[model samples]
Target: MKLKLCVSNTDVLLSTLSAIQPLRKLCVLRFTPVHLCIISMALNEPQAWCKISQEVFPLYEVESIRDNVLCVETNIDPLINALRNFDKSNSDGLSIRLQRRPVANEGPESSKKNRSMAVLSLIYTEHVSMASSRSYSFKIPVKVLKAEIDQGIVEPQLTHAEVLMKLDRDILPLFRRIERYKRSGYICVTGTNRGRLELSIEEDSRKVQLSWKEFLQVQQLEGETQQQSQFSTQDQDMPHSVQIKLKDWRLGAKLTELCYKVVMIISENHALVLHCILNEDETAEVTYYIGGKIQDQE
Candidate 1:
């Protein structure tokens, strides 16, 4: 099996991966004709599922023995370290290739147990200086598991949230303040049809609420007309809110450095979803879902 792709903006892609590095140690990278996706799942309570996407890369040439899609599991730290050499400004382009290689055996008796190994190679180059090019490769082992294991984890339906709105300013500062006070807390989000939204953190004695008036207009998701109408009638008095862990909410803060705008969805005690756009064209998006603390109320 062989797969190769050329990346136009290495900085954007690397920054995207850096955001996911803290979520989990192991990341499952998937490549298809359409997009390159990275999926990571955190352990224990208040678990999170993050998917980072690059819709249109420079290239997506694949040659596989089995199927068109290729999946590989690799350590996130090593991959991130390998990509640190690429300068965001000077780097011309990046190329990634996945292929199968034979595992080397030092002992003579080990030859009998020889097996094929999966290798991921990353090549970074500078168009101006041919001598500045460098290549880094890593052996990313693969495990055999049921294909249905990730059925419901990777791409979840976003039908849970009724109120959706886009924030005007960067939220990293707010998240930084929240992280200092509490590691985990609920994100009480309330929105109105008049394009006003408020995010608050109320835990114990600490209470902080950040409100934005006349931000971007409220966005009505598909089939959300009824909910929008309800919000309009109630004005800003009745706002849909969700309880989410502060730690999980902070996971998406790194995206603020790359994403210009953030779209937030509140499911009212079910879940909180954040869609971050990585590129100006809106072709690439990174979505994060944090399950709410209170699950019963809808």
Candidate 2:
């Protein structure tokens, strides 16, 4: 159902997975209408926490950790029901204290003192009305926290802005013309203003050159599929017009695992073309671009 986990210490975020791995596996195999929520409390502001929620239903693959954000995919309705049930249950303070303290599980037994820690305070809800009636909560203690931390388990730091900036400056600049075309939204030939020119890219050599008008006309006569989508449509739709030019363009690079799609416009060479860099959907963590046409260089 609905699970709420709060971490007070900022550094604990790293080992979150390993620390909860045991519990997660158990819950995954057992819980119904799976929905999970995580809240990270501010170190300075003890009362404030960043909360994220997701549904975990029909026990599937173990989702990997990335960008300090945990993602879980499952059906929505069941998770919603679980959340409802969580709210139904009421409580003043979480209940997680040992009756007579068990022996220290690690190191010397008497040397260690057992301290109470709240790993997570979970709640489950059923229907919008009756859901709140069947809820439960659990708080993990400090001993478990220490064990997880010592194991060095967690996700890497999130430097999305820095990563994107580096990609634009270093990687995209190598194929300045191609990047420009991708942003502009089309592939056009230089020096042909009235008639459309055919363009082709060499896969092996990575070279590019304009095709003859006759060649394109022949293809057209042969009923070959031609790009009917006008590039001007994109330019006209842009809030502002910024033209980019290219010289002897070629497919310089292919991007994979990109979270966002970006469009750029280049200036000076005297033609406008739009190009797209493939985002394989694995590497990128954030959506970089949302709009279709870009307006003037920043």
User: Which lDDT tens digits does candidate 1 get at residues 191-268?
Assistant: 654456676877676778877544545676556566556556544444677776666766655555557677877776
TM-score of 1: 0.76
Tens digits of per-residue lDDT, candidate 2, 1-298, equal 1223332221222222222222122211111123223222222211111111122122212222221222222222333333334334443222212122244454565544443221322333223354444346432222222323323422222221101111232333334434433333334322222222333333353555444333111111111112223435312211212222222132212221121333232221222222232233221121111111233465
lDDT of 1: 0.62
- Cα TM-score of candidate 2: 0.20
Per-candidate TM-scores read 0.76, 0.20
Worst 10 residues of 2 by lDDT: 215-224
lDDT of each: 0.62, 0.26
Q: How accurate is candidate 2 locally (lDDT)?
A: 0.26
Winning candidate number (TM-score) = 1
**Can you tell me which runs of candidate 1 are displaced by over 4 Å?**
42-56, 65-67, 86-94, 106-117, 123-138, 142-153, 170-180, 221-237, 295-298
